[model samples]
Target: MRPRLHIPRPHRRGFLTAAAGLLGAAALGGCDRFAASPMGQRTLKLGEDANLFVQRLLLTPASLAKEFPDSEISPWFKPNGTIDPPDRAYKALAATRFEGFRLRVDGLVERPQDLSLSDLRALPARTQTTRHDCVEGWSAIGKWTGVPLSEVLQRAGLKPDARYIVFHCADTMEYAAGGEEEPETDTTANPGMEARPEGAENQASDSQAAGAEAPADEGDEAQGIPVRYYESIDLTDAYHPQTILAYDLNGQALPVSNGAPLRLRVERQLGYKQAKYIMRIEVTESLKRIGDGGGGYWEDRGYEWYAGI
Candidate 1:
């Protein structure tokens, strides 16, 4: 039987206060445009150079939040968005208990790696029960166990030019119907979007293309599926002591609905930044070339790329 965990309401209030404070600061500084309603415009217009500078300035090793005795842990850790991915490949892996699942870590590194779940578990691990704060205004606390992202980067050996780490996910969002299909002539072509059911990916791709041409409808693209929920963190956040790739929760193997095989644990940011169904990690200098030049799937749709808190 699992132990009952308790999440204090006061902690939730504190988390909200901190988040609002950060968002408020961004707003006062004219950064609120990044978080503008996704249904309006779907792009971050901060420009590459300025965005890079901000990301650099925000980079800092994350300090671990204070921990509590085992008895104080939360009893229930509710699953976040898309608990079970609709992707067949992911479903198959889950059915088999992720026996063959592998995490590929590449890009801007001296050594690239393909690590299995067992391989990750064999490494030294860190465990902490921290609050999971969501952007939509909700929070939960869970005990996560995994190797520090810094440790993984060290093993991969980051190149000097590596400035950001991009997380690629397996989950693809379904968009509204209607739109023309364009052939993939370049890297920017939506790979995952194109693979979606007819009308879904095409509509999404068209909105993205349209958003690129006219910033007016960018909000529409934001309301739609934005490149499938990818996120990037600066080198500093990548090395934060609290930043981990969690594999366990509350002393047990991670549940399938809760990013069973593995998921990122970036405690300082909102929950959306903690991507699940992650398959690839790429190190890059700029997000301009990643997905629609927005740094993240959601960022491509107007969500802030540097979601600092």
Candidate 2:
């Protein structure tokens, strides 16, 4: 059964005024200071517990939002996070329309395989038009088409030790902590700042330019090396019928910015968990070894790893 998404309508001025007052108090009371101390960790843990409690009180389980009809869908669906890929390999793939792109499925599986776009398309497919909710307070609805992740896993033959699936992406975000570039490599292996196209480089120079572009729309058919943005979910979510490796939207191939060729669709969680530009899928028992011992790049910076809502 599809879960019903209950979005409370924005309250009028009275509610806003009251909420603002509370926010003002928290700000004045040294919210940042409390957030930085050991006491802050305890406070955050308590707050998270409260948040989960209140969320349960207000919204239905995400599993209920899984069912819907084609006629009722959101018209303007927006993409969230990492709209443009910065990796040179991804750019080159994008330039050629991802014709040579292949998705590598390995790790704790009986048959590690390198699959092309056509290979994935040939598998049994499923489509769903669903709402994507982000932690940053935005939402959009779009149609997604792809094979059930279960089918892929079954074909690959999961090893008994496989417990979590990890996504490795090509879309590397700028981590002020020197980003993902290997410290040992010199400029030769690393395409210096000079490697970027003139227009893209200019865009990188302007802060506003970064967020100006939205991800590709649902129907974009342009080919290129698909961008690299990977995400992962636990085995429980992996086998859900609603969880898929989407390749189409609005009855067409996914656009470049929208994760052309393939992207993950874990409907139970927030949008960030739904990784795009997926080139590889790895199955493992623990996330302790993946980026920074935190599960995900953002999680390393303190965002909750299990963002259930």
Candidate 3:
């Protein structure tokens, strides 16, 4: 029998905390708008670049992330982000327990190859109990087993020009809904209500984005589009020993609730940086064409790209 991974129900206090967080989300939830705006995106990019520069200067090969003993692994590790990807291809793989799943390793590499589940397991593997920190106020320790990403990159023969390793994932976060009109607070009363209400344009855009349905909404996220989710990291983090494409968690085939098949476990960054439902690994020197041309899915939504903490 497959090992069972349990998730506990939140208590009353936890529920209240969640409710409070949701209320605060409205005022703080303009990430999508910030990502979409040319000015806003440029500003966020500067911040990302600055953060990356600082991290690089302080980071060293010897600066290892903290690890815990097996005894410290949590009794339950609740899945974050998209648990069951609604993608047809991902569904098919899950149906057969991902028997036919193959992780495509391409994008600007000298030796591009598709590594199957067995192929990944056959490679040298490292198992470590590490804590996953989420932007949300919660965390958990899980023992993950997978091959070091550096080993795979070495075999793939990374091109010298490749600077960033972009992770294309299967899970989509939102869909273009039907007739969900952008809420407009037109300030042009008789064409004399000048000045756009002081950032009215920005407010209108943000309000409309809030109406966008998440991927888990009724049926498909949208008509036929997949809710795109992806992330990117520097080659340095890609080659980090702790960074691995995990296929097994807690001593079992990675549960569907926690990114089955394969997922990127970027140990040094926040949970969102660990892109789940991993599909492809693209190596590019620039982030000019990766999903609205930002750094990651959340980053595209205005979340800090380099969530290194």
Candidate 4:
């Protein structure tokens, strides 16, 4: 049986206090409306760039996120986005306990390869207990175990021009119903390096076509179109000692609700930056062509791309 960490308290008031202070400063200084205008967006972009520079400047290879003892692990680490992917391919993998899953690591890397779950576990691993601060203003602490991202990057061998590490995920955010077709099938549980779903492109165009918004009706959701979830980070965070592709949570094989198979644990960033249900890690020189041309799923929707905390 897999081991499970017994967390007495899910919320650490003390840690939350410290996290709040850190986040208040790191949080975007501008409001949504302020970021809506061309000039305002430019200003916010500059602010984001400045924040990235300062954070990177202060961060050292030796510097790490605060790690807690077993006693401090939150009994309940709230699962973020698409707790369980509804995609047919993902469900098939989950049904068989992901025995057929293969994590594709490609893009600008010189030696592209597909890593099995066993392949990842065979590598040197790191375990860290860190707090997860969310952009939604909540926090939780959890213990994570997995191979450091740098290990895989080194094994694959980065190309000289590689600039960013993009995580392609198995979770699809939008899918249209009725006669609309599902995403092209790949026999492997993990998705291959394909373009975003057509629905996702249309959604992007539609949203861009109209800036005005109607207040959301309770429980309303767009149906039938498929947009896969994805996120990215620069080589700096990818190589950070604390950065890992987590396969276990709180000493137990990660539950479906908590990103089974693999998920990113970039401890220094906000919760949204930790892309779950990860299927591929693409080393890229630019973020321009990925999902709405932003750095991440949330980032494309106006959340800051850096999201450092």
lDDT of 1 by residue, 182-203 (tens): 3322222221111333333122
- How do all the candidates rank in terms of TM-score, highest first? 4, 3, 2, 1
- Misplaced by over 4 Å in model 4 are 1-34, 176-225
Clashes in each model (backbone N, CA, C under 3 Å)? Answer: 11, 17, 2, 7
The parts of candidate 3 lying over 4 Å away from their true place are 1-47, 176-213, 216-222
Write the number of the candidate with greater TM-score, choosing between 1 and 4. 4
Q: Which candidate is the best by TM-score?
A: 4
Please, what's the RMSD in Å of model 4? 12.5
lDDT of each: 0.64, 0.64, 0.69, 0.72
**Model 2 over residues 83-192: C-alpha lDDT tens digits?**
45656667777777788888898998888988888899899998888888877666757788999888888888878778788988766554323212332111111111
lDDT of 4 by residue, 162-243 (tens): 8889999887665434233344222222121223334431111111222422112111234435577789998778888999
Better of 3 and 4 by lDDT: 4
Give the poorly placed runs of model 2, Cα more than 4 Å off. Answer: 1-30, 42-64, 175-230
Compose the digit string of candidate 3's lDDT tens values, residues 1-309: 211213233355644544454444444457777556775545545555555555555777436789999899776675666655556777777788778878888887888989888899999998988999877756879899988888788778777577888888876555544523222222222111112234332211111232432344333534555547788987767877899989888788787657777888988888888877787888887998887776877766667778888
> Which scores greater on TM-score, model 1 or model 3?
3
RMSD of each: 12.9, 11.1, 16.1, 12.5
Q: What's the distance in Å from true for residue 139, model 4?
A: 1.0
Worst 10 residues of 3 by lDDT: 185-194
Q: Pick the candidate with the highest lDDT.
A: 4
